[model samples]
Target: MAKERALRRAAREAEAAKQRARRARIVARRQRRRALLTRLMPRRRRTGRLLVRRSRGQRAGIAVVTLVLLALVWFLVDDIALRLVLTLLGLLCLPALVVVALGRRTS
Candidate 1:
Protein backbone atom coordinates (compact mmCIF):
# COMPACT_ATOMS: atom_id res chain seq x y z
CA MET A 1 0.00 0.00 0.00
CA ALA A 2 2.87 2.43 0.87
CA LYS A 3 4.66 1.63 -2.40
CA GLU A 4 1.44 2.30 -4.34
CA ARG A 5 0.94 5.64 -2.55
CA ALA A 6 4.54 6.67 -3.39
CA LEU A 7 4.02 5.94 -7.09
CA ARG A 8 0.76 7.97 -7.12
CA ARG A 9 2.51 10.97 -5.46
CA ALA A 10 5.35 10.81 -7.98
CA ALA A 11 2.85 10.76 -10.83
CA ARG A 12 1.01 13.80 -9.47
CA GLU A 13 4.32 15.73 -9.08
CA ALA A 14 5.37 14.79 -12.62
CA GLU A 15 2.03 15.97 -13.99
CA ALA A 16 2.33 19.27 -12.11
CA ALA A 17 5.83 19.83 -13.53
CA LYS A 18 4.56 19.12 -17.04
CA GLN A 19 1.72 21.62 -16.56
CA ARG A 20 4.20 24.27 -15.32
CA ALA A 21 6.44 23.72 -18.34
CA ARG A 22 3.46 23.98 -20.68
CA ARG A 23 2.39 27.29 -19.10
CA ALA A 24 5.94 28.66 -19.38
CA ARG A 25 6.05 27.77 -23.08
CA ILE A 26 2.69 29.47 -23.63
CA VAL A 27 3.90 32.65 -21.86
CA ALA A 28 7.13 32.71 -23.89
CA ARG A 29 5.22 32.29 -27.15
CA ARG A 30 2.85 35.15 -26.23
CA GLN A 31 5.81 37.41 -25.36
CA ARG A 32 7.52 36.61 -28.66
CA ARG A 33 4.33 37.33 -30.62
CA ARG A 34 3.84 40.64 -28.79
CA ALA A 35 7.43 41.66 -29.51
CA LEU A 36 7.09 40.79 -33.19
CA LEU A 37 3.82 42.72 -33.55
CA THR A 38 5.26 45.75 -31.77
CA ARG A 39 8.28 45.70 -34.13
CA LEU A 40 6.03 45.50 -37.19
CA MET A 41 3.72 48.34 -36.07
CA PRO A 42 4.75 51.96 -36.71
CA ARG A 43 5.25 53.98 -33.52
CA ARG A 44 2.68 56.71 -32.97
CA ARG A 45 4.02 60.17 -32.09
CA ARG A 46 1.99 61.91 -29.36
CA THR A 47 1.46 65.37 -30.88
CA GLY A 48 -1.47 66.33 -28.68
CA ARG A 49 -0.83 68.38 -25.56
CA LEU A 50 -1.78 67.14 -22.09
CA LEU A 51 -5.06 68.90 -21.20
CA VAL A 52 -5.90 67.76 -17.69
CA ARG A 53 -5.25 64.94 -15.24
CA ARG A 54 -8.39 62.98 -14.36
CA SER A 55 -9.05 59.51 -12.91
CA ARG A 56 -10.52 56.76 -15.09
CA GLY A 57 -13.91 57.12 -13.41
CA GLN A 58 -13.91 60.86 -14.00
CA ARG A 59 -12.96 60.42 -17.65
CA ALA A 60 -15.67 57.80 -18.18
CA GLY A 61 -18.29 59.96 -16.47
CA ILE A 62 -17.32 62.93 -18.65
CA ALA A 63 -17.56 60.80 -21.80
CA VAL A 64 -20.99 59.48 -20.84
CA VAL A 65 -22.29 62.96 -20.02
CA THR A 66 -20.85 64.38 -23.25
CA LEU A 67 -22.54 61.60 -25.30
CA VAL A 68 -25.88 62.15 -23.58
CA LEU A 69 -25.66 65.92 -24.12
CA LEU A 70 -24.74 65.44 -27.80
CA ALA A 71 -27.63 63.03 -28.26
CA LEU A 72 -30.00 65.57 -26.68
CA VAL A 73 -28.71 68.31 -28.98
CA TRP A 74 -29.10 66.05 -32.02
CA PHE A 75 -32.71 65.21 -31.18
CA LEU A 76 -33.83 68.57 -29.81
CA VAL A 77 -32.08 71.08 -32.09
CA ASP A 78 -33.69 71.87 -35.47
CA ASP A 79 -30.70 73.32 -37.39
CA ILE A 80 -27.88 71.01 -38.49
CA ALA A 81 -25.38 73.93 -38.70
CA LEU A 82 -26.23 74.98 -35.14
CA ARG A 83 -25.67 71.44 -33.86
CA LEU A 84 -22.29 71.19 -35.61
CA VAL A 85 -21.22 74.56 -34.24
CA LEU A 86 -22.26 73.60 -30.69
CA THR A 87 -20.32 70.31 -30.91
CA LEU A 88 -17.17 72.03 -32.18
CA LEU A 89 -17.36 74.73 -29.48
CA GLY A 90 -18.04 72.14 -26.77
CA LEU A 91 -15.00 70.08 -27.84
CA LEU A 92 -12.75 73.15 -27.98
CA CYS A 93 -13.80 74.33 -24.49
CA LEU A 94 -13.83 70.86 -22.87
CA PRO A 95 -10.36 71.05 -21.29
CA ALA A 96 -10.99 74.42 -19.68
CA LEU A 97 -14.46 73.40 -18.54
CA VAL A 98 -13.17 70.26 -16.87
CA VAL A 99 -10.41 72.12 -15.05
CA VAL A 100 -12.94 74.70 -13.82
CA ALA A 101 -15.38 71.99 -12.72
CA LEU A 102 -12.77 69.86 -10.94
CA GLY A 103 -11.10 72.87 -9.26
CA ARG A 104 -7.47 72.86 -8.09
CA ARG A 105 -6.07 69.77 -6.39
CA THR A 106 -5.32 70.33 -2.66
CA SER A 107 -2.37 67.95 -2.55
Candidate 2:
Protein backbone atom coordinates (compact mmCIF):
# COMPACT_ATOMS: atom_id res chain seq x y z
CA MET A 1 0.00 0.00 0.00
CA ALA A 2 2.85 2.42 0.85
CA LYS A 3 4.57 1.72 -2.49
CA GLU A 4 1.33 2.22 -4.37
CA ARG A 5 0.72 5.56 -2.68
CA ALA A 6 4.33 6.65 -3.43
CA LEU A 7 3.92 5.71 -7.09
CA ARG A 8 0.67 7.68 -7.36
CA ARG A 9 2.29 10.69 -5.72
CA ALA A 10 5.23 10.52 -8.16
CA ALA A 11 2.87 10.35 -11.15
CA ARG A 12 0.93 13.40 -9.96
CA GLU A 13 4.14 15.37 -9.50
CA ALA A 14 5.27 14.37 -13.01
CA GLU A 15 1.97 15.52 -14.49
CA ALA A 16 2.21 18.89 -12.70
CA ALA A 17 5.76 19.36 -13.99
CA LYS A 18 4.65 18.60 -17.55
CA GLN A 19 1.85 21.18 -17.31
CA ARG A 20 4.24 23.84 -16.04
CA ALA A 21 6.76 23.10 -18.81
CA ARG A 22 4.04 23.24 -21.47
CA ARG A 23 2.82 26.62 -20.16
CA ALA A 24 6.37 27.95 -20.16
CA ARG A 25 6.91 26.77 -23.73
CA ILE A 26 3.69 28.53 -24.88
CA VAL A 27 4.72 31.77 -23.17
CA ALA A 28 8.19 31.58 -24.71
CA ARG A 29 6.77 30.99 -28.18
CA ARG A 30 4.43 33.99 -27.90
CA GLN A 31 7.30 36.19 -26.75
CA ARG A 32 9.44 35.04 -29.70
CA ARG A 33 6.67 35.78 -32.22
CA ARG A 34 6.10 39.21 -30.75
CA ALA A 35 9.81 39.93 -30.99
CA LEU A 36 9.92 38.78 -34.60
CA LEU A 37 6.92 40.94 -35.59
CA THR A 38 8.40 44.00 -33.92
CA ARG A 39 11.70 43.46 -35.72
CA LEU A 40 10.10 42.93 -39.13
CA MET A 41 7.63 45.86 -39.03
CA PRO A 42 8.73 49.13 -40.61
CA ARG A 43 8.59 52.49 -38.85
CA ARG A 44 7.28 55.60 -40.61
CA ARG A 45 9.22 58.86 -40.84
CA ARG A 46 7.21 62.01 -41.63
CA THR A 47 8.97 64.95 -43.26
CA GLY A 48 7.08 68.23 -42.96
CA ARG A 49 3.48 68.32 -41.75
CA LEU A 50 0.86 66.02 -40.34
CA LEU A 51 -1.87 65.43 -42.93
CA VAL A 52 -5.57 64.65 -42.74
CA ARG A 53 -5.08 61.31 -44.57
CA ARG A 54 -7.84 59.58 -46.59
CA SER A 55 -10.12 58.51 -43.72
CA ARG A 56 -10.50 62.04 -42.40
CA GLY A 57 -11.25 63.37 -45.91
CA GLN A 58 -13.92 60.72 -46.37
CA ARG A 59 -15.44 61.54 -42.97
CA ALA A 60 -15.51 65.25 -43.83
CA GLY A 61 -17.12 64.54 -47.19
CA ILE A 62 -19.76 62.38 -45.51
CA ALA A 63 -20.46 65.15 -43.04
CA VAL A 64 -20.93 67.66 -45.88
CA VAL A 65 -23.30 65.30 -47.72
CA THR A 66 -25.29 64.73 -44.51
CA LEU A 67 -25.52 68.42 -43.84
CA VAL A 68 -26.83 68.94 -47.37
CA LEU A 69 -29.38 66.19 -46.87
CA LEU A 70 -30.52 67.73 -43.60
CA ALA A 71 -30.87 71.12 -45.23
CA LEU A 72 -32.92 69.56 -48.03
CA VAL A 73 -35.17 67.87 -45.46
CA TRP A 74 -35.68 71.16 -43.64
CA PHE A 75 -36.45 72.85 -46.93
CA LEU A 76 -38.99 70.22 -47.96
CA VAL A 77 -40.63 70.15 -44.52
CA ASP A 78 -40.80 73.98 -44.18
CA ASP A 79 -44.39 74.31 -42.93
CA ILE A 80 -43.48 73.46 -39.27
CA ALA A 81 -44.54 69.95 -40.20
CA LEU A 82 -42.23 67.61 -38.26
CA ARG A 83 -40.17 70.66 -37.26
CA LEU A 84 -39.30 69.17 -33.90
CA VAL A 85 -38.19 65.94 -35.48
CA LEU A 86 -36.06 67.74 -38.07
CA THR A 87 -34.50 69.93 -35.38
CA LEU A 88 -33.60 66.89 -33.35
CA LEU A 89 -32.12 65.24 -36.39
CA GLY A 90 -30.01 68.30 -37.14
CA LEU A 91 -28.87 68.45 -33.54
CA LEU A 92 -27.83 64.82 -33.66
CA CYS A 93 -25.81 65.42 -36.83
CA LEU A 94 -24.18 68.56 -35.39
CA PRO A 95 -21.53 66.68 -33.43
CA ALA A 96 -20.43 64.70 -36.48
CA LEU A 97 -20.02 67.91 -38.48
CA VAL A 98 -18.08 69.53 -35.66
CA VAL A 99 -15.81 66.52 -35.37
CA VAL A 100 -15.03 66.52 -39.09
CA ALA A 101 -14.46 70.29 -39.13
CA LEU A 102 -12.18 70.12 -36.15
CA GLY A 103 -10.26 67.20 -37.64
CA ARG A 104 -9.86 69.09 -40.92
CA ARG A 105 -8.69 72.24 -39.10
CA THR A 106 -6.13 70.25 -37.10
CA SER A 107 -4.79 68.14 -39.93
Candidate topping lDDT: 1
Residue 62 of model 2: what lDDT? 68
Error of 1 at 26 (Å): 49
**What is the lDDT for 77 in model 1?**
92
**What's the distance in Å from true for residue 92, model 2?**
16
Each candidate's TM vs. the true structure? Answer: 0.47, 0.45
Residue-level lDDT tens digits of model 1 in 1-107: 99999999999999999999999999999999999999999997664645345666788888988888888888999999999998888888887887798765642
Instruction: List residue ranges in candidate 2 displaced over 4 A.
Output: 43-51, 54-69, 76-107
Clashing pairs for predicted structure model 2, backbone only: none
Model 2 poorest ten-residue lDDT run: 45-54
Clashing residue pairs in candidate 1 (N, C-alpha, C atoms within 3 angstroms): none
